[model samples]
Target: MGVRYLFQIGDQIVYPMHGAGIIESIEDKEIQGKVHQYYVLQLPNKMQVMLPVGKIKNFSIRKVVDTLTLENVLHLFHNGETDRTLNFKERYKSNMEKMKTGKIQEGAEVLRDLMRMNKEKTLNSSEKSMLGNARKFLSSELGLINGITEDQAIDLLNYRIGK
Candidate 1:
């Protein structure tokens, strides 16, 4: 398959399970005697990842949302639906699947549901971690989209979500 590069250096993108990041560089590296182009991203968690250009399509890599979509995504904080019927294990599995989708909207929904659950009763340790990661992912993307720091985006999310 022909390589199709979707993002350039400095472009903001989401690298699922790792939150959002900026494309730091596009470099050709020799791995196991084969040269391939890789996208090196500077992640929000202070991590860097090198993904192969040709294999990016195998993942759910996508550009960040525009301002209009950002508004709608943040809206989920207030109006998103929650699933409170599942047992603890089932709920955790379900939320993991949603987070894997790498969609900001879905992540927001997960955050919303988890927050609501915490309001009713304290979340378990695993869920608390998931909630923190989800919040980070959402806030990172928001920061990149609106040109604010992740802390500021988090503040905005909290303000909008009434946290």
Candidate 2:
């Protein structure tokens, strides 16, 4: 619990299992007779999460990718191949893990793969849900980094995938 704070108020960060968020505040809260520092993040979904400062690294909390990394992720959409051999359950689990990493590239891959699969055949309920979630994750980050609307980001991704 001696780790120094890595993020400051107003910094943009990604919380694994969630999408892009901004650090709103750093506060000390007393619980069980111990004082703990927490990072309050306001997510793109408008939901807020308070995370313990000591556990941020363990939870994979990280800053949003820079422009170069964003460009690389966009490039991935154009050339990434879908692994269609995996069964539904296997693919779902794998994709879920990737999404949980909260990396822009991984989210883009999941979105691209699911879109390709959807084109080949109708996706089941689970896949359909994952597709929506992946899209949200990708678009949220894209919108934040590129200063565009989420709808615009979704259009950009679809256009890239179609290319």
Candidate 3:
């Protein structure tokens, strides 16, 4: 199975679109006479979010990246650039989808692309928001993995990206 049940109780994980949360417990419950297994999650940053087990994959929840992987993801921001789009709505939708996918590497791509486009011209509101979200998400995960504050992680990433 792609989903691992080995996430320790109380360990923090990133659910990409949902940001950071802790795995509260693994529970076996019955719903409509069916036995359901779940990885109960408590979102520390979000209010009253208790996630069920079977839906974790559908929810895009995964363990946070390791320090080495986080380093490589930061390095990606300086490597490749994406083609800019003329349609603001389309670009926003595409970048939002990427951000929701829970792949740090892809988030780096969106960040790099948006920054490049921003330098060429001022971004529309949607694009600007997406850029901010991508940067925040990446930095938050980096913070969790590196044991640093979110602002520190963002500063380190910006310095590495030479932004």
Candidate 4:
């Protein structure tokens, strides 16, 4: 029998460290003589990942944001002050923790703060890379949101950068 799943095919979701994607299908597979259910997720960048259905809880997988929620999340870009007092190492650690949550809001905060910091002074190699990954996460989910076209999503990702 197939395992119960909270998400169905075509459901948009975020996979921590992997960015956002659509659930392409559910299938059963046997490994080491044991059967396991897996969710085949198709990422926005055309990459695909198959994760065990039973392991999603441990992995922090979650659904994409809704329109209203997205609006509020994006507001971080235009308003609010970033935590600039923390040293670079401390700030990076905090952002890394936020990224691990796989939550859209947290990802947006990371993106917003990092982008603002980048504006103040160029980030180091590691942070520049982190900023890029945050963009990938936030933009991919933004594009998956209802009424948001891919182009519009890209625009949203770039919105505060120009300010």
- Candidate 4: list runs displaced more than 4 Å: 1-3, 146-152, 160-163
What TM-score would each prediction reach against the true structure?
0.93, 0.90, 0.78, 0.90
Task: Name the top lDDT candidate.
Answer: 1
| Candidate with the greatest TM-score versus the true structure | 1
lDDT tens string, model 3, 31-73?
Answer: 8999887777665444435566667667777788787887777
| TM-score, cand. 3 | 0.78
**Per-residue accuracy of model 4 over 7-63 as CA lDDT, tens digit each:** 899898899977888999998899999999999999877899998888878999988
lDDT of 4: 0.84
| Model 1 stretches astray by more than 4 angstroms | 1-4
lDDT of 2 by residue, 1-163 (tens): 6656889999888876677878999999999999999999987767989999888888877898898998887787778788978998899999999988887888888888998888888999989999998887877777788877778978876776672
Q: Model 1, range 55-99, lDDT digits (tens) per residue?
A: 998879888889899887776568766777899999999889989
Task: Give every collision pair in model 1.
Answer: none
Q: 50 in model 1: Cα distance from truth in Å? A: 0.8
State the lDDT at 5 in candidate 4: 77
Comparing 3 with 4 on lDDT, the higher-scoring candidate is: 4
- TM-score (C-alpha, index-matched) for candidate 1: 0.93
